[model samples]
Target: MSTLSKIEPTDATEPVAEVLAEVKKALGAVPNMAKTMAHSPALVRGWLALSGALSVGVIPAPVREQLALATAEYNDCEYCLSAHSFIGSKVAKLDPDEIERARHADSADPHAAALLALSDAIARGRGIVEDAALETARAAGVTDAEIAEVVGNLALNILTNYFNILADTDNEFPPVTPLAHA
Candidate 1:
């Protein structure tokens, strides 16, 4: 059971219903996170607005999902871990290894690897990363816009991760367990 009310599409009304429909239209399903967030229409709208903005960001969908996976693992949010794992592989077309590597904020591609490393630093440093982290990302071909988008994506993931953990949101996606990192 969730700490918060989990609104189902059938039970939703008015603003919540409209937003949930939009979510379903876009995603083909209303995820449990959105259903839980429907408890507050403002939260749903705020999340959608930010998410819509970031969809066109320089980070790309795969990398954005990678950051979300990394953030979910960092926070140990099972709901998000499972959800992103599904979205990462199914929607973003990332391979299983890439999805796993993302949890550790790693990637084989140098550009993605740099961003993931910066993501790891951001998570570990609590957003107070060292200068060299940014420098390294820049050196690896990350742009200023990419850095900004990474932070934006990180913030978005943290919002969902914390919300799901706080709400104890039931997992609506396939289960994914966290692995011990080296």
Candidate 2:
């Protein structure tokens, strides 16, 4: 059970309902996590703003999704791990094997592998990534800017992961079901 109770669509009212309506229109469904976040509209709005800004950044969608999944896995966040895995497979066209490999931060390919390693390193709150790791990222064609973006993405995922743990948010998308507890 969730530590925070989700605000149901049926019970939404006034200012919160307005935001919930926008959330529904945008996502097609009010994810339980969003409902939990509705406890503080400012938090929800701030999260939305940050997400919007990040979406417009230079990182490829696949890389962004992979980073999110990797971060979630490192943090043991079932909610985000499940959600991002599904997004990785369906929205980003990442292969199932690749997704699983990313979840474990294990890969034969250096680029994908390096990204996983870098994301994991940041997820641990380690401010300084080793020079060799940065070199690996550079060899993968990742720029210093992209590395910074990955750090930002890592921070984003950590925020969401912590929120999921605190709220025990329910999974909304069906495709991620099998892997939710994996």
Give the worst 10-residue stretch by lDDT in candidate 1: 173-182
TM-score of model 1 relative to the true fold? 0.94
Clashing pairs in 1: none
Every candidate's lDDT: 0.89, 0.77
lDDT of 2 by residue, 11-77 (tens): 9787788888878877687888889888888777877777777787877777788778777777778
Cα error, residue 11 of model 1, in Å, equals 1.4
Candidate 2 ranges with C-alpha deviation above 4 Å: 106-109, 175-182
Candidate 1 ranges with C-alpha deviation above 4 Å: 180-182
